[model samples]
Target: MNKPLLLQAQRPFTAFAVRATPLATLCLVALLAGGCASPSYTITPEMQARAASENPAPPKDDDFPAPGSAKWQQGAFPSLEALRAMRTGMGKDQVRGLLGFPHFSEGLAGVREWNYIFHFRTGAGPDYITCQYMVRFNADVLTHGMYWKGAGCADLLKPPPAAMQPVATVRPTVVAPAKTTLGADGLFRFDGRSLDDLLPEGRRKLDALARDIRSDSGSAGAIRVTGHTDRLGSKPYNQALSLARANTVRDYLVQAGVPAQRMQVQGRGESEPKVHCAQARRAELIDCLAPNRRVDIEVLSGQ
Candidate 1:
């Protein structure tokens, strides 16, 4: 009896060893030692009944872990690619390859259900939302059904819409500046300088010009109506007469629907001549200088 003396342990140490340990802790230790086998849970009818109930509570007996429990709290931040890789009929190992182990305490082997907590980015900086996901297995333990606890969470797993293409802009057409010459003889009576003195042909030509201007109004710019005379009258008198004739033509054009603001009038009495007559006879000179007495209308294009 003296040779077999009992070994005495400290009272504090004995109390620490007597505390109850969780089954998960024992399984974890066995797994580390490579001696633990994957466990299977028999799905009792009562368990199925509870799962099918409206507003069912968190499952007990290792069916489902309560929210904020140690197993449920172990969440993962999975990428969009990983979430998209999940599909039906995948084996437990394949599912585990993409999304790690279940966040809940469901065993690894022969598990009919796996629940997880996944965090997804909201695409607004670093903002993210936590979602609960569940995967159900068939009798062969292959994945068959997937579900989400939150509304709109499933939509996040789908791809985004395509980008829009830009449209080209069209430019307006611009007509070049053009100059038209009208004989004063055709436009008015001899020595005419007023609207009353305008000949019928002159009024008709002016009407046609107005129509052209109106048709190109969108691209039409400034219009210049210039009057020229033959070298027959005094410089000042010719100048005044030319100016008056130009004004009359411009007024007629305005009344014919050409914009008044876009038109300007000028007179160049005996200044610019198209032909210089050498004839000495008055009638011959008048006829020869006919080209010099005329009205020039120049229309400019839009900028």
Candidate 2:
């Protein structure tokens, strides 16, 4: 080779060799670092014994029904609607008259507990019903308590998943399961007229509910708002209105950062009518068509 050609070839070869050696060294270092290394640990006999020991937590005090105040409602067809509407600290005798004999009772600490579970069959529309009440007492008087639907007892202490939300009913069959019980469920007659009416106070309650949801760091699972109509309206209209009401609340939560997936809404229209005046719904207070116009909210945990 000529001098210039030989020089060029030698220059390229030298550079290639220099880079190859450094690249090989870097790969070796990485391979070594990727391997695991264990630090030394020692456990003495006394240390091992201490580590194996376990202590169970003591039961915490339950601050529900007060001392000597427990009373319950029992028997078939005992007017669950009436009981559900009663106050948390209502008198025991009052509940007895509204619901009938005591099914079962238990005592704890200085207080007593009264439990009621009611079930009913559906008639023309909507099938199956379940109700539960957990009441506590003191001085033979009602003190503190809560209600649950289906097996919602555990819910009083633990909430459900965040992603599991209530939403608009997809169809008649797409009914959402119960999450909790309604506090005051009956005496419907809606004294106020206008089937599509939104109570002036409803906005306030809604704002409060939304505040609770947002303040809870989006913990409230779903906002279930149902809109209903008297038998006078068409099914489609009722369904649409029910959906709109539910979405109105659901959207508010979303704006407050609640996940959209955490909510569901439903509309039964004239389906679940309040049965007290099954024959005629007009005359009675909080009449027979009451069930058609209500919404429910429930919360759950997430995976």
Candidate 3:
């Protein structure tokens, strides 16, 4: 081989050795530090909230409020009167009127059951402990209800009276329902379902009806309003619309002097139609089905 060729090969070897020396030194340093290095971190509420936004966090037993917190009291809870009003075979609307909505509406075993959360003091130093109330339904009718197992549910039911009252020998009041049915067309425009949708004549009629109800009943008692819709929409949609309409009427009645405790509302949807529309698809079909869309109001006549 020529001497110049030998020099050319030697130059490449020198450069490689220089590059390898630095990389080997770095590897040695890293290996030495790896054994003694310790890392620590703090997680703040900000971090927790960020993590929550990225993933669903299931509720924990620890989520129960601390003792003496505002939530520990009976805020937004079913009252004693509501609990007493509940009865077997009552409709969903009636139950809702008694206890408001269930606390946990994500019913177990499908949509046939509902769970309500409540808290009560045990005086045993447990503070306001959490409990559950459960109700089961068959179709739209209530079947039964249950209290949280082993949670002293019965004790809360008949709590000790705050004070004693002199026993009075007086007859109890008796109340009966007086039903009234009104056509929806007179109250609403087409498919409207809000208080704002009340026609002028409808307002007058409702005012008169409210007066009649108060006069006929002699006292403001339990009021029940059931809303209906024509068979022109899906069941779920019609049900929701009918419920909205019923709520509107209920609110108006309450504003007009009916006691909220005495009011219950239901949405019958297209289930109880007064007349059947023929198969001919015409404008007349909707008008012919008008009788199906209506509201039924019932007030308790007291004695």
Candidate 4:
């Protein structure tokens, strides 16, 4: 009220904004522009390899290989023998399971080498392997692919040998046991045509005898085991082999239910042969070689 406060404050009024420095403004614009740049980028070969080095990359088998471009036919698969079993021109699916995926392709047909490598668990470290298979194709169809794995890859190209003998279960029946007594030497000689093919009864009887003796200590006293074989092989070998078999029978008997302390074992191989031809055909052919190959187990009061 005193003269309308004639003092209109004498302070000056200035603009409310502070101007930015050119250098600072320039820095800010540059940073924003850099951040807004495009994310799209072209990957170089070297960059791709660097990334691959950090992680393993799967093998490539996409489009059909160019005819002249060195490429092994089909995919990696099983053993050469197994692959050879497949008919020519088989589809990829037919041989898929028989052999697994092809490892890697080698060069073109002429001396082309492919290694379908795999690992097997053995005593040693992983069984390192590389199998080179040769595939010969006529036109577009695959004629035949010589498959072999491991060293000597070229060998797989050849034909495998035919099995001559009746391998596995196809073997001929050389001897079928029957019950028949041999010479008067108190031995067994079963008709096996050969000494090697002795029946179980000859050995099983001794085992039983040993068990019976072992169970009863009284029988263990004066235990005498006599062994015999068919009329084959040298006197010494046959006798020794017979004795060993007899001892084995005795040991088995002892293990089954016989006392080791009260047991005796012996052998007399091939000293006797099957005099009774008829009995040799049956399962209990022991009588045929009873005297020849046998183990006489006698228990007496004295050991």
Candidate 5:
């Protein structure tokens, strides 16, 4: 009789256990579904207003995920050029290509907004400003708008002023001497005043001078060629010889590529002596007066 009573009690307990199993299973399924559901990424009217605002307030907790959360990504240090390149109607991938992954929990797909914590240098120095940036997307997931939390942060995307930009170092141009002198004795045969009298050494020297003048043609201006003679001949005769020598030198230079229009010829005979020799011998006098008999070339710079 006691065994029968115990069996009756066991039947009730088994019935209760069977009923609880289905309820427990249903609860487990419901919990799993809730946990696996994706977060809503809808952009509300309020969010749009804030995004449109020229000066929006800083974001609150609702605007971003908690730090260290599963969706929170540490922000990046983006280049100013890249940030400036951002434009409306850019696809999500293109935006991501420039500024790395967004710094908030907003998922890549089915999301209409992305937030960032960007660091920008204030100047060339190490000092930087930390600003919150937001990129809003349309229903198509293409970027439609952008906003900044800090004042003047948007200005960072613009190019700096001309004065604020780095100035290139400009080295001053070195000007060559305006006047150059060459010995007539080195330029021609003794008592020679024509182009035919030019020695091989004289031709070579003139060639080099032509090359130099051509190299500086951009700055070279008027060129004056003057000839001087020693005090051995009559003033009138010496003057004519000097003038002939000046004309010959100018003509030779013109053939060597110097512009004839830029050259002017002059003769200063038996004047402007560099040395007054007291020597009695004719050779000594000629040698001492050699410095006075020469051609002077003057170049005025265009600058």
Candidate 6:
């Protein structure tokens, strides 16, 4: 009835289908490429079991119980029954097998004694008392064993209650300034002041003295450095030399941590004679007068 009109209507629908075909093909290509490039993931039973079985490494010493603790004692020291079983005829290797390693083995080359150290806690704090099991051996065979209990270990059976425990009193160490007299011969080369002029022995001694003074300087007060010369040099020259030497000593002390304000330099040239030598001119006489040439270090009260 209307063939030409029906054919004309189908023409527009066919043209629309043709335009959408290229766009659909591009989308399909992108989807297929993405699927090919991506890797698929799946967990097998073996992989799940391996993941469940994997464990972190055991803890090291830093993770173990602190030293001198009950956990430490249990982990380190052997039981009392093991010590009791140690007979006089047990070989060194046998004893080691039962007790593990000794904490300290003394006189190994000459004497045969193994010391096992054990720590015990008496209070809530971390402080612990040490107990040693000393075993003596004759030619590597156990001869006798003894238990040496330390200070607090004696009361192991009945640890004193915290209230009843004898409180340890730590007394403040009183460091007094010592008056140390050093011979002048040991310090300088004859009558020199520069550190280069000091003998090696004298330098060592001075350094040691300076270290001691500096170490205890917290409790040290004024340091008096007095220099004395022999009766050989002129009074003016002796005084000047003595003062120079005293100044040198003061400088060294300052460099060694002693405050500059804490030092007092004086030249008591030939004023103090430790040894009285009669008038003589031989080398022996010169040596006899050596005690007069000296330096005196006096450490006064602390600030």
Give all TM-scores, in the order shown. 0.42, 0.31, 0.44, 0.28, 0.42, 0.41
**What are the per-model C-alpha RMSD values against the true structure?**
37.1, 28.8, 18.0, 30.8, 32.2, 32.0
- Against the true structure, whose TM-score is highest? 3
Q: 1 or 2: which has the higher TM-score?
A: 1
Residue 238, candidate 3: alpha-carbon lDDT: 74
Candidate 6 lDDT tens digits, 211-248: 67755625657889998988875666676667667877
> 67, model 3: CA deviation in Å?
12
TM-score of 5: 0.42
Whose TM-score is higher: candidate 4's or candidate 6's?
6
Q: What C-alpha lDDT values do all the predictions have?
A: 0.70, 0.45, 0.62, 0.41, 0.70, 0.60
Model 1 lDDT per residue over 30-60, tens place: 4432212244445432332222222323333
**Overall local distance difference test of candidate 2:** 0.45
Model 6: ten consecutive residues of lowest lDDT: 32-41
Instruction: Output the worst ten-in-a-row residue range by lDDT, candidate 1.
Output: 45-54
**TM-score, cand. 4 vs. native:** 0.28
The stretch of ten residues in a row with the least summed lDDT in candidate 5 is: 47-56
| Candidate 4 structure quality by residue, lDDT tens digits, 45-66 | 2332222223222223332233
RMSD of candidate 5 to true structure, Å: 32.2
Q: Record all residue pairs in model 5 with backbone atoms less than 3 Å apart, i.e. clashing.
A: none
lDDT of residue 74 for candidate 1: 47
Worst ten in a row by lDDT for model 3: 31-40
Better of 2 and 5 by TM-score: 5
Per-residue lDDT for 33 in model 2? Answer: 30
At residue 203, what lDDT does model 4 achieve? 52
lDDT by residue for model 3 (116-163), tens: 566666587867756656555543233344334335664565434324
Candidate 2 stretches with Cα past 4 Å from truth are: 1-198, 217-230, 255-261, 274-276, 279-281, 285-288
